[model samples]
Target: MQKTEKPFVEVNNLYKVYDGFSSVLDNVSLEIARGEIACIFGPNGCGKTTLLKIIAGIDKDYQGKVLIGGKSPIEVRTGIVPQDYDMTLLPWRNTVDNITLPLEVNGYSRRVLREIVVEFLKKMGIKLPLLSPVYKLSGGQKQLTVIARTLINKPEFLVMDEPFASLDSSHFFQIADVLKRIWNLTEVSTVLVTHDLVTAVLLSDQIFLFSPKPGRIVHCEKISLPEPRSVSDPLFVETVNYLQGVFLMGGE
Candidate 1:
């Protein structure tokens, strides 16, 4: 018998209700292939973060099946980067210390973990102010530190919620380029939540559009643009405009 292939990540009939009244997500289903970067784009209150929380094993009240590599989210090696970089990062910890924090949890010595962080930064081509405390870093630098900390453990599935939400245009593109570099280096399957159509077009292999509250998968767009994409490219602009039109038309 031929083997049946399964998706790397699967969400089937997902429904989330708060206090048995508020319906956040309804009958949401989607499949993500291994090593692909998928973006979740939707209006505010459409349960994008709820879905991400469910996938990250942070929220367990929802009713539905969410699987990562045919196992529950808790069973997988998952890394999560929340939108609030400032709140999540340790203000007292410097860049290397913060990046090594996860390893420290597993009883790794600080010296060893610092070596690992150094190697990881080298591999990812990332340079940070290693001695500066996270609170002293700029917004972009803080976000990059959070990302580096999450990625240091080499997670099998990565979940990022609006990673670029806090950056200005210059830092936004800088971080976006870093993300592309990370994808090239690790190819870690990622589910990123973002409100920006341009970001979705630039980073995702598949873009999942959700409806307003009681969110469902309204559309799943495949982005076939070549890697190292540029906003100046005509096709890239066209794709962003098209997605914007869809949003303006209320996902019609």
Candidate 2:
């Protein structure tokens, strides 16, 4: 077979099994191009989140290769915003501190870290008041803060697992637009794992539908819808219905 160009992120012959119960991901493989937004969709217990964890380097016990920019996921400069925002944020630190923590840990100078964190805060519509004591903020605010934190590093690749799960419909769309703008501005390759088919359709250049049990990719659909897609548009509706049908068939 002819080889494709090197992908920004590539998973080859991956397998993940816990305690020999069963393989969560069985010989799965995928490739994502630079600056491309790829969403992985699957039913619960289908190992979608597990696959994200493997790509994020949080779970390293899996077999096979996961490459980010031709390097292992742990060795690559990448950022992750998990589905559980609480896990990504430090409860002791305020929002600003939490957002800057990654930069600080990476040894960025104080001035540069502050500037970058502040800019991301503004981009995410996160005001200073919400920056202090993360427990005081609302769910949506916390989620936005997590996103700001993830982007502060200016990473080459971003891994997001249902980053908008807590937001209301209005905030969800607003944040979605912000994420798109940020991705375009930074040219970051993004992998977003979400159960919301509409959000996945709107944000991704390609969508990978996963099989139910083994969580292997069943379909990879290229989205040709025009940018700044209106959710109400007929084309958007048709695409969503088609993907939804695929998901239903997969038992999601």
Over 1-252, each residue of candidate 1 has an lDDT whose tens digit, in order, gives 342577899999999998899999999999998998999999888999999999998998888899999999988889999999988998887888988987877997788889999999888878899988788899999999989999999899999999999899999988888888988889999999999898899899999988889888887889999977998999999999988887777778
Show where candidate 2 strays beyond 4 Å: 1-4, 106-112, 120-131
Quality of model 1 by C-alpha lDDT: 0.90
- For residue 89, model 1's alpha carbon misses the true position, in angstroms, by 0.4
Residue 124 lDDT in candidate 1: 84
Residues 105-213 of candidate 2 have per-residue lDDT tens digits of 7787877877787777776555655447998877777877777778877888899988887778987976787788787678899999988889999999999998887
Alpha-carbon deviation at 129 in model 2, angstroms: 2.7
- Candidate number of the best TM-score: 1
Candidate 1: C-alpha RMSD after superposition? 1.9
TM-score of 1: 0.96
